[model samples]
Target: MNVLHLDTSALGTYSISRQLTAAIVGQLQRDGVASSVSYRDLAAEPLPHWLPNPDPASDNALRDEAVLQQFVDADIVVLGAPMYNFTITTQLKSWLDRVLVAGRTFRYGPNGPEGLAGGKRVIIASSRGGKYSGGPAAAMDFQEPYLRTVLGFIGITDIEFVRAEGVAMGDEAKQAALQAAHATIGELALRKAA
Candidate 1:
């Protein structure tokens, strides 16, 4: 299987989401599930913020199409999504803008909008500073829900989140969250093997 691994964290080595995504991809490789892996560090080489361009042959349009083709060709996508101010990073959003194209990833049909890109699995390594999965902070969580909505809009229903939340709460909480995320990755590998 072809795996497209994308890291959008500006934290680099200190990023929890980056660590989780690396572990997840490693697990997939060890389980013999990934035949090839394509890695992209969005933080290091960010895509430009999209704008309307009438020229299809423009450099920006070409770059956008290339990014979209990568998404289209992948069998599985492993994304490192670090929550920033309760939402995804600007780098990731730029990447999404390239892929969520009209008649390419989705289209307007008789019954409304229809997603053309389907059958690929998306694994998101979601890292948050505080607990947002439940309780009072759940309402403030725009990260995971926004990701699900956009990805689902593109017909990717098979999505899984390996979350490592509350990392900034304390050292103990960070360790616990990492451990849990690692365990989830292992479980996913076992299930894929089965």
Candidate 2:
């Protein structure tokens, strides 16, 4: 099975989300599902927000073909994202723009909208600087909600999220968030066994 790991952390080495995603991927690999992972780092190799001659930059094509193909071709997808000012990174958004094709991944159904590509699971590893999960600021979190909509639109409805919030408050908050992230990863690891 193919697992696509998309990491969008602006801070390369200091991103808690990226660390959690790595843990998740490692756990998935231990399950012995014949898994293969595709890594996409948006900051280092950003997806084109607007294509320059429809070129697929960094092998992404700045279009849906390669990006959607990654999901359409994979059994699972793991997104590592960091909240920037209450929203996700622009680089990740660019990647989404490439994958949410109108006809290929979705269609104009009689009901309204329906996901075409089913059976794949997506796990989002998100990090926020402040205490926002289920808080009054939670509604302001456009990262997770927006990702849910965009990925859901293109036939990927089954999703699980591992969020690390309150990282920027202080060292204590960051440590707490990291601990929570690890706990979530362990649970996912157990789930993989089941």
All models, RMSD in angstroms:
0.8, 2.6
**Candidate 2: segments with Cα more than 4 A from true spot:** 52-64
TM-score of 2: 0.90
lDDT of 2 by residue, 75-122 (tens): 888889888877888888887776666677778899987777778888
Candidate 2 residue-pair clash tally: 1
Residue 92 lDDT in candidate 1: 97
- Candidate 2: deviation at residue 143, Å? 1.1
Q: How high is the lDDT of residue 61 in model 2?
A: 52
C-alpha displacement of 94 in model 2, angstroms?
A: 0.6
- Write model 1 residue lDDT over 63-155, tens digit each, in one string: 888889999999999999999999999999999989999999999999999999899999999999899987999999999999999999999
The regions of model 1 sitting more than 4 angstroms off are: none
Residue pairs in collision within model 1:
none
